[model samples]
Target: MSSLLGSKEATNRSFRSIADLTVLGLLTLLLAALPLGASGYVLYVVNLLMVYVVLSLGMHLAIGETGQFTLSHTAFFGIGIYTAGLVNNHWHFPFPVSILASAAVAALVGWVIGVLALRMRDIYLALATFAFGEAMQWVLLNWESVTRGANGLRFRAATLGELQLVSDLLAYPFVVAIAALMMALTFAITRSRLGLAFRAVRESDMAAVAMGINARAIKVTSFVLSAAFAGVAGGMYTLFTSFIHPESLGFETTVMVLTMVVVGGLGSVRGAVAGAIIVGLISELLRQAPSYQEIIYGVILMLFMMFLPKGLASLVNGRVALKKGCAS
Candidate 1:
């Protein structure tokens, strides 16, 4: 009887593995086709979506996987932007160097926050993170010599490798490629051992600790990983906009990212990407509309939260379950 049960479990795991691989393949094909078939504006939105996709993934690593309700992601995001900006603007470093440096700095900040907040419980941790985010914005706003204060700093057009992309159409593919690679990396991490540990920590930290898992190390690791991803997203945002500002690192922006994760799905990585697309497109579309835009956004978010608490990802799961039921 035990052997039979083990066999069944193994079979279920195999099925899940297949399902995940199929999804990955489909996403790859879709990404490959978009730049070839889509319009320039569509491609531009896709590029923007790719960046948020990374940012949302980072948020998912904390909120969804490790159950850390952090409001300090925007600060980490700023770390990346300012890191790249300072290096490129002053030191004349290469793009890769700036991005790497930004990621490292953001990870350091995450580590510091994690260490200091180790003893804090839920809301306390959230408040502390929120304060850290606000402080980061203040620093950026007041640091005129480096950040240029409220005016922000614009960069000259950048190149990837030897290719100087003068058009958005040209640059769009480059950004998309990097974002896609990062997304794959994130997906891998979500399916690996560390991901299971993250989920365990999220579900019950005390239980996880009792099970011999070092909860503190898991929390800190997830935090640092999330911060690194946020840094990458921020660097991309800066490059795409050709400028960096304190507002990008503010509480409002942090809320925006949080909205993306929550509205998409709590623990669904793919859902986070989907949520970004929905919010990003809706926000851009409503930019020209009347005052109703903000109202519409709030309404949609409320409706989704009420009706689809698990998020749109739940719909996918439901469909898959239905298909399996039919097969069985």
Candidate 2:
């Protein structure tokens, strides 16, 4: 019976793995084909959606997997934007260079914050991160020489030799490619030993420590990874937008990212991506009804939490489970 149970579990794992590969393969095909006939506005919207996917994945790593409650996602995102934009503007480095630098700088800052805030937990941790975000925004607003003080920073077009990504259509393929790469990386991480450590810490730091895990280190690692992903998202933003200001990087942006992760189902990478695409498009459409946008969005989120708290991913899981049971 024990052997039979083990075989069943192995078969289930195989099924999930095959399903994941199929979905990813189809997605890659779409991303590779999208820019062929897409309009300028469609490409622009898709670019932002990809950015949100990266941001939500970052949040999932930190909060969903590591159980860290941080409200400073946009702060790291802003850091990435400015770092990549400034580098591209001043040094004319390739987009990859600027993006990597942004990730490194953001990870460094996240490490600092994680070290300082590790002592706190729950609401205290959230508040502390929120305060840090507000402070970062203030700096972006007041740093006249650096951020251009509310006028917005207009960076040079991201370039790789003769290939210049000035327009949304021009940058669409790269943007989608980067976002897909991040998704694949996230999947790989969640299947590795480090991912097991993250989940153990998330379940209970004290229990994880008792089991010989360096829970604190895992938490800090999550923070750094989360920030790096956000920073990359920011760099992706610079590729097409070419301009940014303090106003766009605020707590609301953080809230939207948080919402995406939660609505997609916490701790599920597939959910985060789907949530980003669905919620990102909805948020974009909500712009037309600025006054009622918040109300409608809030209602939708509340309803999801109330009825489908496990998120859209839960439905997929249910279907998979049903199939597995039928096979058994």
Candidate 3:
């Protein structure tokens, strides 16, 4: 009976996995075909959605998997944007090179923040990171020489050799590819031994240490990796956007990413992706109604929190389990 039950359970899981992959494949096909018939505005929105997906995934790594409350994600994202934008604007380097430079610069800054995190936890860590984010915003706003201060920094078109990407359609393919790569990387990391260590640390650092895991190292590595993800998202942003303002890289942006991760189902990868897409679309749609936007957005969030606290994934999982139970 035990073996029979185990086999049945495995079969159910296999079916669920297959269903998920089928859905994902269909979505990818649809998205790939979008540019063929869609308007430039549609492609632009999709590209922006992909960037949010990457950004939310980064937040998920730090807060959900590693159990770190990091409020400085936008700061690292800003670091990436500025780094990539400046490099491309000055040298007209290829997009790949600029993206890599952005990731490295953001990772380096993340390391410093991670070291600071080692000495604090909970609210103290949150406050410290929040302060750091605000400080970075200030620097971006006041540093008129490099960031162009309040006037914003505009970049020349990103290019590949002689092919200049002058429109959203031109950049869409690269944006989608990079976002897919980040998603795959996130999945791989979450399924590895290091991912187990991250979960263990999240559950109990003391217990993880007792089990011979280097809790401190895992924490710091999480920060670094998360920041790198945000950096890549920023790099992706520069691919399509011509101008970036310092005002856009502040607490409000961080809050939006946090909302994406939390509303998507905290630690679940599917949740993060779905949340980003859904929220991104809603945000874009709401732009048409500027006056009621905040009110409607807040109400939707409040309803979600009150009704589906565990997130959209939980609601879907609940239905799946219910069906299984009914079948049994």
> What would the TM-score be for candidate 1 when compared with the true structure?
0.87
lDDT of each: 0.80, 0.91, 0.90
Off by over 4 Å in 2: 326-328
TM-score of each: 0.87, 0.95, 0.95
lDDT by residue (1-328, candidate 2, tens digit) is 8898799889888988898889878987887787788889988999999999999999999988899989999999999999999999889999999999999999999999999987799999999999999999999999989899789889999998899997998898889889989988998999899999999999998899999999889999999999999999999999998789898887778878888987899889989999999889988998787666556667777988899988899999899889878877
Encode model 3's per-residue lDDT on 264-328: one tens digit a residue: 98778899999988888877887777566556656766877788877888988889888778756
Candidate 1 wrongly placed segments (more than 4 Å): 1-30, 36-40, 289-298, 325-328
Lowest lDDT 10-residue stretch of candidate 2: 289-298
Q: For residues 147-241, what per-residue lDDT tens digits would candidate 1 score against the true structure?
A: 88899877655556776545557777667777887778888988999998999999998899998899999999999999999888876765555
- In model 3, the Cα lDDT at residue 25 comes to 96
